[model samples]
Target: MTAAGGGAAGEVDEGPLDEIDRLDAAAYEAFMSEVYDALGGRGRDLPARELHGGLVEARGAVHRAALTAEDVATVLDGSLVEAIESVGRLQTQLGAVGFTLAREAAVRGLHRDVALSLTDWLRVRCPWLSTQEAAQITEVVKACDSPVTAQIGDAVRDGTVPLHRAALVARTMSRLEGSLDVDQREAYAEIATRAAGRRDLADKDLARVCHQLVEDLLHEAAPGERERAAQELRSVTTRRVGPGLTRVTIDAPDGVAATINGVLTSSLAAPAPVKDEQGQVLEPDTRSPAQRRFDALATTIQRGVGRPGAPPSTARATVLLMIPFDPAGGVPSGPATTAAGDYVAPRQAAEVACSADVTPVWLSADGAPLALGRDARYATPAQWKALAVRDGGCSFPGCSALPQWCDTHHLDHWARGGHTDVARMALLCGRHHTHVHQHDLTATVSGGTVTWHV
Candidate 1:
C-alpha cells in the first residue's frame, strides 16, 4: 500500500532539506567568524556565549568522529604533542578571559542583580565549578582590581601566566605589602609575573622566589619580630581527606623543615632490603617512595617512645651551631641562621647553646672564616655526657629529641682540625647530624652560649 502524501513510507524531498542545511552551515560559519574576531587571534576575549558555543561545537565534532585509540596513534608524535599543548594553551586562555570577565562583572555590580555576591552567582550559574575553583577565580578578580597587581592579571589574561601562579604572586604580594612600598611592590610584581611567564619555571621555583623575598624582608626586621613571626608561622594539622586516608600538613620555618625532612630521608627511613626469615636475600622493596616514607615515619615514632629518661640504645648523631663572632669584641656580629637559612635569634641560640656542644667561630668583616673553635673527630664519653647535660636533646632548632637519641657532633670537622672536646661538641639527632655534614654547617660557642650560622 502507498503511504499517505508520499511515494513511500519514511521518504521525503531531499532538495529543499539540502538547501536548509546549507543555510544553517553558512549561518554557523558567520557566528564562528564573529567569535574568532572577538578572541583577537589568541582566544583572549571569548565572551561567555561564544566560549560555550565553541565548547559545544568541539564536543559535537568529537562525538561525531568517534575516534579510537588506533586513530589517535595515527598522528605523528610531534603533531600529537603540539595538538595537546595547543588545547592546553587555549583552555588557559579561555580561563584567563573568564577570570577577567568575572572581575568586570564584579566591578559593574552585575552579581547584585542576580545573586548576593560574585562567588554566589558563579556557584549558582556554573555548577561544574568546584567551590575551591570559584573562590580562586574570585580571589584572582580581587587581586586584579589592585593597582599593584593588575599587571599580573593582564599576564594571566594574555595567557603568559598560569592562574595558580598568579594567585601565588597575589598572596606573596599581599604578605610583602608591609615591607614594600607601592613602587617596590610593582617592581616585584613585574619580576614575578615575568618569571611566571617562562615555561621552564615550575610552581616550586616561583614559591622559592616568594620565600626568598620574604626572607630578605625578614632580614631587615628586628630579631624579636622575626622570631615572633617564625613562631607564629609554625603549625601542624591533620585532617581526614577520605576513608582510611589522612592528609598531614606541616608549616614550619626553613630550619625546622630541614630537620624534619632530614629525619624522613635518613638511612633508617630508606627502603629496606626485603629478606626471608632465614636472613636470605629476597627481592627489592616494591613499595612506592611515599609508602616507604610513611613506614619510616611510623618506625621513627615507635623508636622515639623509649623510657622517659633512657639513654640511647645505640650511638646517635651530633649537631653543631655555627655563629659568627667579632674577634675583637667577642660578640655576635649578626643573627645566626640554620643550614636551611631560617634565622635564629640570640635568645633562641642562647637556649640551644646551654645544652648543645658549642663551638666558637670567628669571622672577619668580609665574612671570611678567620678562625674556628677547637676541632674534634669524636667526643669522649665524658664529653658526650657533658653535652647531654648541657643540651637536653638535639640542638637543631625546633627539635625535642632525647639525649640518648643524639650523637656528639664536632662543631668543626676533625679531619679539618676540629677537636672533640666537650666545649667544641653538640648532641644532634641522626637526621640533623647528616644535615650538618651535608650543608657543611658551622657554629660558635662563647661564654657558654652557642650561635649558629647558615
Candidate 2:
C-alpha cells in the first residue's frame, strides 16, 4: 500500500461505482418497461408485491436505501415511490426533464389502473410497438386522459389513431362517463352490448367507439326534435298551494308572470283618525295624489330595471325644512314631539313624504340644506359637492357603502329648531336612514366623527 504502487492508498475505487450506475440504469429501464406493460393491460390484476420488493432492493444496491413495511405498502397501494425511483434514473439519462419524481409518481399512481387497461387494449389493437415505443405510448395515453384532451381522444376512437391515441381515448371516455344522461346511458348500453360481439376491436376501443357513435347521433338530430325528446325523457316536479292572505303563485311559460296578492281592507274596529292641536285631522300627511302615483311608477320602473337601491338622482321634489327655533317652547331641536304630539321634524316629515315615493329629502341643521340646493345664488353646486365629498358615502358604521347607494341624513330634528348645514348633516343610505329612527340604532355627529350607537 505504498505511494505510486498499484495497490497504493492514492488509488481510487471506481469499479464498483461504475458497475452500480450501470446496473441502476438497467433496473430503472426494466421497471419502466414493466409499468408500461401493466398499463397496457386491463389492469384488473394488481402488480405483485414481490416484484415491487425486488425492484426496491435493486434500487437500494445502486444507492444505500431502506424502506419500511408501511413504505412498501404505500408504494404497493399506488404511491409515487416507484415513479420517483424511475424518473430519478430517467433524469440521469435525459438531464432533468422538468418533471419531478414525486409529481411523476403521483400522476402514474393515480392513473395506473386506467393506464394498464389502456395498454392491454392498445397491445391487442396495435401489436407492432417496440419496447421503448410502448412505454412512450403509455405516457402519451396518460397525458391524453386529462380533462382537456377531448378532441385528442375523439380522433383516436373515431379510427384516426395518432401517436398519442390512448390519451384522447381515455379523456373522451372520462368525459362521456361524466355527461351521460339516462337516454345516453341506454344508448351506450345498447352499443356496448352490440360491440361485445366484435372481436376485432379491443374492449377499450369498443367502448370508445360506441360512445363516439352515440355522441354523433345526438349531435346530428334536429335541435327541436332533440329538445322534445329530452323533455319527454325527463321528469319535472313542482309544489302547489291553496289560497291565503298572502297568496303567491308562479305562472306557466304561456301564462302571466309570478304574482303576489294581498287584501288591503282595514282591520276589525279600525282606529279613528286623530286630530291635531287645532282640531285638524291628523291623517297621513303626504304628497299629492299625482305625486304619489308618479313615485309609484318611478319605483316600479327602478325595480323592473333592477335598481331598487339606487340613490335619488335629482332634488326636484326633495325638500329639507329646518325650524331653526322651536315654534313652541321646552322641546329640544334634534328629535322632539310637538304640542299636538306630532313629530314635526324634517327627518320625520321626509320619512312620511318619501313613503309615497317622493324625492329623497335630506333633513339637517347648520345651514346644510341651503348649501345642498341646486340654485347656486341661494346654495351653490360647489357647496353640495363639498358636503357630498365630506360625508364620503353613507355615514352608518360598518357601512362604507358607495355614494350611489346613499341618502343625506339630518343629524338634528328640523321641526323643533335645527339649521340645514353640513355640520349637522351626514350621508346615510335609505336603509340606514330607516334603521336610525325605526330601529334601536342612534346616529350622532360630534367633532367631525359620525358615531352610531348600535
Candidate 3:
C-alpha cells in the first residue's frame, strides 16, 4: 500500500539513511512480500465475497495444519514471532479496510436506503461487532467525511494508519470542534497521521497520548466548558465479581487522578509482622501491591467519614508538590508534579493546599530555595528525629502507634500561651490528639519522658 508521501508504506524517504533506517527499509520489504504471499498475490482482483471466503479457507488450512511447538521451532530460521507479526499486520490492514468501506457506505447513503441507522447497518453485515464498536465505526466515518479529518481518513484508506488510531484521533477531534482553530485542527490531524506511522507505540500508549492531548486542549476551552467536559468524563463504578471480591473502576480527569493516586501512595507502608504478646517474631505480612492500595483506600475513606479511631491524615508531612507559578505572567504555568513525578493540574494542587497543612518553599528561577513560608512553629527535621528517638512511639499511654504515624503535639497548647520547644512537645496519634484536646487532658515531660494524665 502507498504511504501519504508518494512512497510505499514503511519505506524510508530519500535521505542519508542511518543504520536504523536501512534496517527499517529491509524489514518493510520483507513484511510487504510476506503479506503479498499470504494473500496469494491475487491483488484485489477477485470479488469481495470470494476474497473473504478465500481468507477463511486459508485460516482453516492453517488451523488444520496443526503446527506444534516443535514444528514452530523448526519453521523458517527460528521462532513463530515473525509469523505472529505478519498475521497481526494483515489483520490490522484488513480492519482498516472495513473503516474505509464504512466511509463509502456512509457517503452513498446506503444506510438511509435500508432505513437503518449507520451503526445498525454496519453491524447488520458484521454481526460480531459490538454495539459500541459499530457506533465507533460510524463516528469515525463521520469524522473522516468532515474536512477537518479528511487527510487522516485518506491515510487510513491508503493503509498508512491503523483504524484504531484514526478512531482515537477522530473521537478527540470531534469533541474539540468549536475549541480548535483551523490551524490547530490541521496540526492535530497531521500529528495523528505521524503517530500512526510510529510502529513502536502500542495502542494503549497512543490512546494515552490522545487522552492527554485532548485534556490539554480542553483546558483552553471557553469558561465553564472545560469543567463541564471534565465532569462528564469522571465516573466510578463498582461490581461484585465473586462472593468476597469486588472490582471498583474509577475514571477521572488527570488532576483528580493524580490526587487520588497521591493520597493512596502516601498512605502505603510496609505491612508489619503479626506479633505475639511477648513481641516476638511472627508471620510476616504478605499483601500484594493491589491489596495494599485497597487497604490504603479503605483507610482513607474511613478517616474521611470521621470514623472514631481513624487518623486524620495518613500522608507524611514531607511530601513535596512542585508546581511552577509565574507571578509576572499572571497565567497558568503548567501541570503540577508530585514527589513521585505524577502530574496534577495546578488548580487541583491549589485546592489541595487550601485545607492541607502546607509549608510553601519559595524558589528562585534556578530552583534555589529563597525562603520557607511560615515554618517557625513547626518541628524541624532534627527536632522530629530527636522526638522520635525520645518518644519511641505515640506518647499516649498504651498506644503502640509508631512515631511515623504520630504528630508532634504541644503539651502546653501552642495556641494558648505556649512556646514551640521539644521539651514541651510530645508525639501523639491523631485520635489521641483530638481526644486530649476535647477532654483538656494534661501531659508532663520530665527527663525526656512524657506522662499523660487522662
TM-score of each: 0.40, 0.24, 0.39
* Model 2: per-residue Cα lDDT over 204-276, one tens digit each: 6765775565457457658765544333323222333455433222222211112111111122112345689
RMSD per candidate (Å) reads: 24.9, 27.6, 26.5
Which has the greatest TM-score?
1
Consecutive 10-residue window with the lowest summed lDDT within model 1: 309-318
Q: Candidate 1, which segments miss by more than 4 Å at Cα?
A: 1-66, 110-120, 224-454
Better of 1 and 2 by lDDT: 1
Q: After superposition, how far is residue 237 of candidate 3 from its true place, in Å?
A: 10
Q: Weakest 10 consecutive residues, lDDT, candidate 3?
A: 307-316
Poorly placed runs, candidate 3 (over 4 Å): 1-73, 76-79, 113-115, 130-135, 219-454
Residue 299's C-alpha lDDT in candidate 1?
77
Superposed model 2: Cα runs more than 4 Å off: 1-314, 318-350, 353-381, 439-442
Clashing pairs for model 3 are none
Query: What is the Cα-based TM-score of model 2?
Result: 0.24
Model 3 residue 225 lDDT score: 76
Q: Model 3, residue 188: what's the lDDT?
A: 82
lDDT of 2: 0.45
Instruction: Return the lDDT, model 2, position 58.
Output: 61
